[model samples]
Target: MAKNLTTLALASLLTLPLIGCMTTNNVQPIATKPFVIDSETYQSAGKSQRIKFIVLHYTVSDNERSIQLLTKGKVSAHYLIMDNDDDKIYNLVPEGERAWHAGDGGFAGRTILNDTSIGIEIVNKGIQPQYKDALKDSELDYHPYKHFVEFDEVQIKKVAQLVQDIAMRYDISPKNIIGHSDLAPSRKIDPGAKFPWQRLHEEYGIAAWYDEADKQFFMKETQLATPTIPEVKQAFRDYGYQINSTAEWDKASRDVIYAFQLHFRPLKPTGQMDIETYAILKALNKKYAGRDDFY
Candidate 1:
């Protein structure tokens, strides 16, 4: 009995400090008073997600320089995919925080894209001068648009996976999965012609693309009468490009068309409204925007 009493007393003494340190509820001890957060019971139903788009880009430099510029420089992106054999992905900025990647651009009537989109920068040496020189005199004129270097196959797969994950989480529209060039056609042309948008659409089931049958149908109509410039501009606008109905094929219009062709018809992005280009545009607007009539 004496030995049992001694053990009980020792245990009581050992627990005294802990008991004294406990909160009023006696659940646990806290070093200092803490602000209580009540998250278990109530949540508001009026909230919606802020992320609406994903904008892709190419860094146009080596990996080291790409990281340096994105991290230290004025411009930044949420993610960066290096073009190395390992195909590493770096989260440069958090998705919740707005990166300065989308500057002076809008998409599908949404302006200030930086607030509503996540940007991904892939390290690539864009548009080698030798390639440009070779294409300059070729009959396959892509005048304002040039062939950008192809992304590493491994790098592209990682990009597709990242995009898939984000899009699934945010429920972002396939049409809103776009390139830097798509957002600001006049000022930017990145994730350029060689970005393999078709591959992403076909293989990964990512991004919006026109139906081949729809395109073929529109192609036949192209032989009737050429679509007017204003009509073409309106088609572009309806298809989510920030093009104006300026009534003529101006430099700005050409730039926007170049951006479009860079994504869709990369082989000959001449910035000219040919039969093929018109048909492609109409097909896209019809499929994506729910427009039945050709412009």
Candidate 2:
């Protein structure tokens, strides 16, 4: 009976540690701060849609890398459209959440667009390697070599469908559909010259397009009297570019012009204030200037 007691005591000692370990592992510490839930019977009178703009971009990398970067890295996009033969469109982030695609940019009268924009990242090598090399040499102009790969037709169709659905749901304006470069002229140049803005404008009505007759008339008038730099800068600002209304044709002004030409006169984004570029700017501003919807 005494030997049995000794064995039982040893077993209890061993079991006590196991029991303590189990208790330690299973129990979770309670939070110190108190959280309360509240219910309201009445709703606020004034509210608006969180989403205001749809900003487009090109990943400048392959589809796989683009996905990995956007998902795992600090930068992210709401949607990523692949350039593969399949033309797959992937949703990386939910529409309700803000994506980090438009890092530091603005449009219309609003700054920091990431707060109010949905970003779409399309897979495309923004510039060919040879073209990039030629650009550094100064011996080659962008006209000869293809600046970017053409977007697949199926991909564009899918984008249009997605845009249409989102626009309908959020009541986004056609003018608010813009490229990343348009918002961040100083920093970004994605959804570059090759992006089919005209096609999107004509077919899907995603963006605004100026009338051809008006553009031609303005182009002709520029020959007689070139508008001052300040006038052109104000026109650009009125068209929603975040350009300073400086009288001089400074570097900042040129950069804004580059962003404009990259969207409108893509073949030659010379960054110079020329007749064609000025005409397009004037036409766009004349149509969209001082609209209450933009802000």
| Top model number, lDDT | 1
TM-scores of all models? Answer: 0.80, 0.80
> Superposing every Cα of model 1 onto the true structure, what RMSD results?
12.7
Candidate 1, 1-295: lDDT as tens digits: 9999999999989877775566677566464688789998999877667898999999889999999999999999999999788846899899989999999978888889999899999999878756756655776534344456878998889988999999989878788899998989988878888889999999998888888998888999878777788887888888788987778888788889888998899877887778888898898887777421211
Q: Indicate the TM-score of model 2.
A: 0.80
Assess the local accuracy of residue 244 in candidate 1 as a C-alpha lDDT between 0 and 100: 73
* Tens digit of per-residue lDDT, candidate 2, span 1-295: 9999999999988767565557765776566675655558667767778898999999888978988999999999999888776746789899999899998778888898889989999888888866766667685433231666677787788789888888889888777888998999888877888888888889888777787888988998988898888788878877888988667877777778888888888888877788999998888777765542633
lDDT to native, each model: 0.84, 0.82
- The window of 10 residues in a row where model 2 has the poorest summed lDDT is 139-148
Task: Estimate the lDDT of model 1.
Answer: 0.84
Cα displacement (Å) at residue 268, model 1: 0.9
